[model samples]
Target chain A: MTPDDPKDPAGQHETVPGTSPGASPQGGVVPDSRGEFTPVRTDTPVADPGLPAHQWRPTDVDPKLEKRAERQVAGMFVAAQVFVVLFVVSYFVFDIGGDGDAILGLGASTVTLGLCLGIALLLIGVGIIQWARKLMGDHEISEMRHPARSSDEDRTATLEALRVGTEESGIARRPLIRNTLLGSVGLLGVPAVVLLRDLGPTPGEVATEQPYEGAGLANTVWADGMRVVRDVIGTPIRAADLEIGDLVNATAAALYETNEEGELVLEGTERLIANSKAPVIVVRMEPDEIEDVDGRENWTVDGIIAYSKICTHVGCPISLYERTTHHVLCPCHQSTFDLADGANVVFGPAARALPQLALAVDDEGYLVAQSDFDEPVGPSFWERG
Target chain B: MRLLNRTAGRLSRHRRRPVAGLLVLLLGLFATGTFYAAFAPAQAETTASDAAQVEEGRELFLIGCAFCHGTNGEGVLTESGTQYGPALAGVGAAAVDFQVGTGRMPLVQPGQQAPRKPVIYSQDEIDALGAFVASLGPGPAVPEESEYSVEGLSAEEQEEAVVRGGEIFRTNCTACHNFDGAGGAMPRGGYAPSLKGVEPKYIYEALLTGPQSMPTFSNGNLTPEDKADVIAYLQESEEQPTYGGFGLGSMGPVAEGLFAWVVGIGGLVGFAIWIAAHSTRSLKQKGTTE
Candidate 1:
């Protein structure tokens, strides 16, 4: 089957015998022994009925103009090399944050390194294009048709085309474009190598800055005295307000803030993170019904106690309350906890009990935290073991 | 010799008095025997009627419960003295009916406490055996049907009863069972059985029976209709469609997010990748061929 046949799977286009695929069928166009030639057609229709005779560019006619174009292309390549060098220098000179020099709100190292690397790549690209267009082969060649598969002759022809293209590009004759094109591409490697320095120091500095001391994956904003409040509304709960069997979804007070107008403030990602971490399930039982944990006698005001709504398994919030049993169930994975028994894991895949938030009645009678959780809340961690 | 013979003759005459004394002692012994026979302890001599009831109850207890509880109601003690079947000595008739009438007594095997099973014993038999056991020691009594019925409650009283019932539900029920009465798992293989679809009578019986892991709620603990009110709430909650989209097991947001993430996002990512690969191949094939 012919390569260009509609049903052909491979991309090769067929060539007619006696003439190349690009040869004109008219006399004087190259033809083979059969005296027949295949005409090549451009995709565009003969608009303007074929334009006025093509005007030769200056470089096509004047050798000096071509030489100057080659030189200009080479200059771009040399400049690219300079920027690559600058990229390496900036890597060493800039103090990422140790010295704290900021450029346009970014660290000096980041801006300088990025700028130099970008310029270096851009110059390399421009230099190559200039060499190809201004000095590369302008003359076209035609060959006789052959089979689609690359025969020995076709392989030799391809190699010849590549050599012809390089000569036509004038890389050998025009030292300026040739050297700059080579230099620019070679320099491109410098930016790539210099950028490696940015990756640095294998392990990162321990995140020991503000709000993150010794606190890794297991820690959150929860601490002693953090009041349990409604998630978005931030309203503090009074034990008296909740009747028996009521399940209130709540979060830590720190999740909410007040605007200047005294309006509640919870916005963006901050609100989302706080809501996820501090979810609490509040339930009211008979005072007698609560199985008081040792030393947590006053944890509940009246019969209301709050426990981390986050499941001790994979952290699904639990609100399925079986009041008669004083059990709160994590619906995900069916982890059941006895709220009365310190939210101890009574069932399911949960490895530990839901952490109970020790609660107390403030002077104003609102429920407040007596203390942070005695242990970490949510799923157990490897470090914790 | 003549004086000794006369004294021996007088002593022989006095022998008549000794024989009369022997006859009086025999009469006293007969009278004591009759008195003792007349007033023997009432409990020891089971009357024909009491005997008949005890015999009937014993038959029923053996047929229905003796396999695990033991033939004599002493409970089958293991070598370690750990009794698998609790001794029924002080567990009164109420306990028996609550257990057996609720179908919780004759457990096939220990599981998450057997739920109230259908009673295999007749009411009269349950009571009779209850009495027999109660005779052993004072224990919790089974409540009559009358005790379970709420007395002449006004609208306000009913409302208050329900409100208190809600309180009880939150405190005791909400832990293992959901606030909505959906059942939850318990420690080990046990579970807090769902309150949903449970009949009010069944709820009352369950509380009374302490079926399975559930602790019994005697009259001293939760009144009968108090159980009824909680049952009522559970039934009512079931009838109402949970507001705001699907309840997603009524487990709240985290599960919803997980469903969305694992199931929803996973499906989306899979679909996206399929579409990407499909479109890339199809579009490129179309471009190259056509």
Candidate 2:
């Protein structure tokens, strides 16, 4: 039976333009070509889906409004250029690892660079959204559903439609916007490469750059006759000052050093990095309380001993002292060191003993280093041995 | 010639009889005894002054401290048979001076720890008490005020003291008191009180006495200069201005994280909502006017 037959019910329903995709109650009453009533089956409920009438955007209809929106979008791209330039300037101008240049507890380099880059990205995103909402062509489109399997002729027609849509987008015609967007996005890559410089100072450079010879990862600022000063205030320690059971954090006296005019000589990053590695804890116990370590008999001066503050496990400054037991704990990972027995690892994951500093009294009565720590301090690394 | 002849005669006599040699040795011993007797009074005089102070301190101890510490200051037990107070006989002068000087003892009520309060006893009474406590047994003696003071030190020495003080404070006190000396929690109910407004003299006493759970930083341990350095660090910390903005108690990362989220992110979120609302209103108004 032919579907175009005047009595066919299914062919009649397909002709309705605005009707919802469902069967009408009166559908089955229509007679078929064979003069019998046929049932029309549909899973969808019947309802009239009335779509709202399209309203024109002001920028779509008014030439002046459209011109304003185009300029506004271009302005955002211009603002993005400013932010990108700021990001580059911030990279060079701000001290990345210096004291007194922190904002919100972060380095000024970190805060300014992040803000500039973030704003640059946000501007590009906002500009694109504005361009789409106000300047781009506005129209409503609807397409009827086709069968899953397409004929050879329909596939050719779909490709032709895509070509037409691309032309209507007008991207190539708007050279000003297209060029500015490309420029801002391309500039973002420069900051990415610039930020990579923060990875760290090159290997072997730090030691060579130091003013004091042999002062670096391999050697601390301590040397023969340099007084062991208190870490912050820079006061020299005396052997007679500390009593048994007292633990004091100390550093190389070079940190507190001043020029002839009395101005601080180590004022910034150089001082910070050097002091962190050179920190040590001085503990005093009775001469009898200490166990004799082979070859280290004279390391202690009147029951006072010095050990590197850096934990061997992960290089955290270890200072939680149990005076009675002569144990010091690292808060970072619970690594415990027995100070009396040459600072041997007693618990947790540390594998080696903390480095000990040989001590002597200077001519002026303050505690001074007999020499630098015998071994490299801090966490064990491949080149450490 | 006559002296030489006499010496030869005595030597010949000693050789003939060993009793003559014994008589010479006993005479030498008697001469040494006379020399010791002349010097003994000078040493005893210094102790006599200390003994007078101890005698007066004993009377004050009976009236003020003997109730909980025992009549002999030997410590006592409670009704339940538990040791209510520890024996203070051998704690020395430093312990008594620190406990009473800081006003932690003569405690109104007993708790896990004694808090610092206004001292009830006069300064002389406190010193007398210290002397009596010292006489009971040998222990760490009280340190003089000048021992932990930077007043007479040179500019360089004073600077060194402050720097060393910071180092010592970081190593010893930061565990319980925090980096800023704002105090922090202990394992149980105890806490390290803030050192912000504490007197320097009191700080020295606190180290010497090791009030509560704090271990005594004795002359043998921290040393007088070490204690002075610690005091300098504390004073420096108080004088320092908050570098950036509000320190938020200098609680470190946790407080900073909270401020960033609430103020920074919340401001951005509020700005976004305002933009969204304004955009919708303008769009609706334009459509209606058209």
Best by TM-score: 2
TM-score of each: 0.38, 0.50
Local distance difference test scores for all models:
0.66, 0.77
Q: Tens-digit lDDT track for model 2 on A209-237? A: 45564456777777898899866657788
- Regions of model 2 farther than 4 Å from truth: A1-212, A221-241, A252-276, A287-298, A313-325, A329-336, A341-352, A359-371, B1-94, B103-128, B137-176, B185-191, B208-244, B258-290
lDDT of 1 by residue, B112-206 (tens): 55665567767787777776666667765665545444446777776666666676676456655767776656654667766766645556655
Q: Whose lDDT is greatest here?
A: 2
Per-residue lDDT tens digits of candidate 2, residues B161-241?
888788778777886678998875543355667788887877887787566656556665566787898898898778765
Compared with the true structure, model 2 gives a TM-score of 0.50
Q: Which stretch of 10 consecutive residues in model 1 chain A shows the poorest summed lDDT? A: A201-210
Encode model 1's per-residue lDDT on A1-385: one tens digit a residue: 3444443334334333334443443422355478665433223234235334433445556667678988999899999999999999998998755433365434577778888998899789868866766667544445555546555577789999999998898887899988888999999999988888666532222121223311333444566666667543356776566655455666777667578997646566655655666778777767787886888887788888888888889987666665457776666687778987888877889988777777887777777777656666777665565
Looking at model 2, residue A107 earns an lDDT score of 60
Going through the candidates in order, their DockQ values are 0.01, 0.10
